[model samples]
Target: MLDKNVNLEGKNILVTGAAGFIGSNLVLELLKTLKSVNIVGIDSVNDYYDVKIKEWRLEELEKEAKTHKDSTWKFVKGNIADRGLIDSIFAKFKPAVVVNLAAQAGVRYSIINPDAYIEANIIGFYNILEACRHSYDNGEKGVEHLVYASSSSVYGTNKKVPYSTDDKVDNPVSLYAATKKSNELMAHAYSKLYNIPSTGLRFFTVYGPAGRPDMAYFGFTNKLIKGENIQIFNYGNCKRDFTYVDDIVEGIKHVMQSAPARKNGEDGLPIPPYAVYNIGNSNPENLLDFVTILQEELVRAEVLPRDYDFELHKKLVPMQQGDVPVTYADTTALERNFGFKPSTDLRTGLRKFAEWYKEFYKV
Candidate 1:
């Protein structure tokens, strides 16, 4: 249900990466809260993971839209890398609010395919900025807030426990992180030059039902199902603040309304309307304990049989390149502005994933 306090009625909001986990979820929430709000969502729907899951998310959104009294939702299958397509969509939609969740996600994958990152993250993001700058070109244009996704990877193996938005993020271990950091930089430049109200969200380990299968939980689940030994990195020594998708969606909704207004002497100042925040659980969980809890939940969800051999089917190895030791969020900025912070823990979030995976796969 939409929050009665928040009214996005009749506003045209564009959500890029609408077919991805967080994007699809955000689309649903926007529809419920706003009256007759037209949501135009775009996704390249590449084969990074199982494209089937992406297709399923779109189908689910279509079903939701079909039930609504008015057809306020439109899903476009295309790459953000396509400048012509991005410009055309902007010209037609003339969206008032733009949320960019469309990213070439995954840290390890970025290392393998450097070109994809350059193309999608760099080229694609530039196209978004260009289109957004010119979105109000004609007359009385309504491009207001532009929100894009950043990553916890920007912290880049910091010794700091709670990674704050104020901390220096100059060094990123992976190309993906580097690209995301570049995105923040690019958005900052656009916000300053074009006077676009841009907000970048640096999301921490987001996981939930219908989440990305490439994540550790999903990969581990798949391996466990096939009776293959799951490899534990860093000798099972790592920590993550697994945030629930719903919480992240709610945070975005709140930010959309407030829409960072430029001020003096602030990060978004001068280019004032630009801001960045860390949306995370703010509570880190040890990886070994996380796996144990996840296994228990999988059994409860019936994804795994009782008495599954847990001891023999696992191996702890050294950490991989582009991998971090731990991540926690200092959500002071988010809380100060939005009056809230993500608080979902690993067990609860994993349980949701286990249930959904069971139902989706009928395991």
Candidate 2:
């Protein structure tokens, strides 16, 4: 395993999308793990799903912060797309590690709201790159590592069993996928030009308690709770590498400590200092089976009645416009470099979600 180069303890770290599912979890993990660390978070807290959920996450962070007396937490309510605000935060915080997780996330939503994708995914990311590039001014130690979120959607509909980082991702099937692909390209350019050590993580279908409501597992739960039919896309043939939120956060924490080493090639210039990796379970679960597990978990958690008619609430439907058949991740490189891989099984992960949902919704 590659040796860790950046130590997170006693450092100022900036995490965008602070109120988000993955972001909030990451922040909590950092506070719990590191002593004497300062974290600055930024989020628009838009009403994309439920603002109350976002607020609840922030409240959790507040509670977590109280226990870690040596650590400091500051949150800014704003958008990363706002250049002035982003620049000001970077200038003030001067974070040693920057994690960018703010973006328009849904594939289907991107179909109708392409502008949000471009504005947040494209322009917002560009602003981040610019800020990172400028952070090294006056021979100051700038961002040691820049880690951002990418999606498995970048693979499109490749027939390959397991997607690899070395595989071609030039063909993106959805606008959301295209934007994520664009983020990889933009980061690569900044890394090459400014010698920023940047890493992009291609996450599979990430789900858990307090997750994004637009995701299949969460959405299906909501619809089933209300007695509405939940559509099983691709006629129940679709498969996904459903990764748990805690596993994803663990991978991120590992990556944050180890940035790509900066070195000069034969040309006497920087070697881009860039890398990308896939963080997934490497085990794909069929949609129908996934739904069945989710249903059983809900019943076990008392979120749904044991006698609820699940058959009446599930509908098999054709593939949506911006969806792929399957997504499997090849995590060989991740394990080789970090000695870590996501191992959370569907039943275990779904059980946590069901329990959390039961408590959160007062079922």
Candidate 3:
């Protein structure tokens, strides 16, 4: 079980993108478990979605700080691509574990604004690596683990039902997927050369309260609220492994302790201290089924009327370019290693999201 109490006393943790959905949740859990462990959370808090939501997440951090005054929870509002800013943070806090979740996250948006992905996903990640490289004095307990967020989008139309880390990820259809794949590759090289134990987590369709509004579920909700037709891509035939945000955080918390290691090189020699895992719900749900449940939950939560017109309010559109047919994650390795898998039913997770959306939007 991932709920086991793990002590991270005295470990200074650094979380980038701490304003984002999964990042904010992970920060909360870390504060809850590790008593007074210093955390330096960095987020650019750009207008990726509504900046107000990011502000709300920062407010959560503020609340956490008030509760644990001695926890040393600090937030730095700046872009990670700024080398001077990142280096200064590294010199000041000297975090022991670095979680990189800051990235320009959006598949369709990437096609429109590819430069944003390059700056944030590539350049920003490079600055983080460099900062980590300089953190240690003669390699004495600098960074114990460097965990980063990858995406199932890297699967790129893989014929396999459940994609694994061992699967070939060379065919990234979108620039966003390419950047995530590039992050894994870059982490491998840095881990091999600098001995920075790094782990990459491939998150699949994370959703719940305080989730990304840009995702399909949230977008559907927005469209439904205005009595607009919701576009069902691929004629509502796609299936996805929609892992809840809390479950994703739990997986990350469990993985924080299980750091990667160098492989035994040439009969007891060491390979790069890098690994990747898919943190996803094993149960894949159809897109239409997910929407139906979401709509039902909205009605239950009173966000939508008991008899809101859903029949004529749906448009079956063709799949967008760079869109995959389905996204499924093979969690056999994740279960075997972490002894945990995301088990939240799509209804259960989406219901919570519907409730939150209703409240947040005051609909």
Candidate 2 structure quality by residue, lDDT tens digits, 1-363: 988999999999999999999999999999998978999999999999999899999999999999988999999999889999999999999999999999999999998989999999999999999999999999989999999999999999998879999999999999999999999999999999999999999999999999999999999999999999999999999999999999999999999999999999999999999999999999999999999999999999999999999999889999999899999999999999999999999999999999999999999
Cα lDDT for residue 349, model 2?
A: 97
Q: For model 1, how many clashes? A: 4
Instruction: Provide TM-scores for the models.
Output: 0.95, 0.99, 0.96
Give the per-residue Cα lDDT of candidate 3 at 190.
87
Superposing every Cα of model 2 onto the true structure, what RMSD results? 0.6
Between candidates 1 and 2, the one scoring higher on TM-score is 2
All candidates: CA RMSD in angstroms?
Answer: 2.9, 0.6, 2.1
lDDT of 3 by residue, 8-90 (tens): 67788999999999889998888887767889899999997999999998898789878886687889999999999999998
**lDDT, residue 283, model 1:** 86
Candidate models: Cα lDDT each = 0.87, 0.96, 0.88
Best by TM-score: 2
| Model 1 misplaced stretches (Cα beyond 4 Å) | 1-7, 263-270
The collision pairs in model 1 are: 262-272, 262-273, 268-272, 269-272
* TM-score of candidate 2 on Cα atoms, chains taken together: 0.99
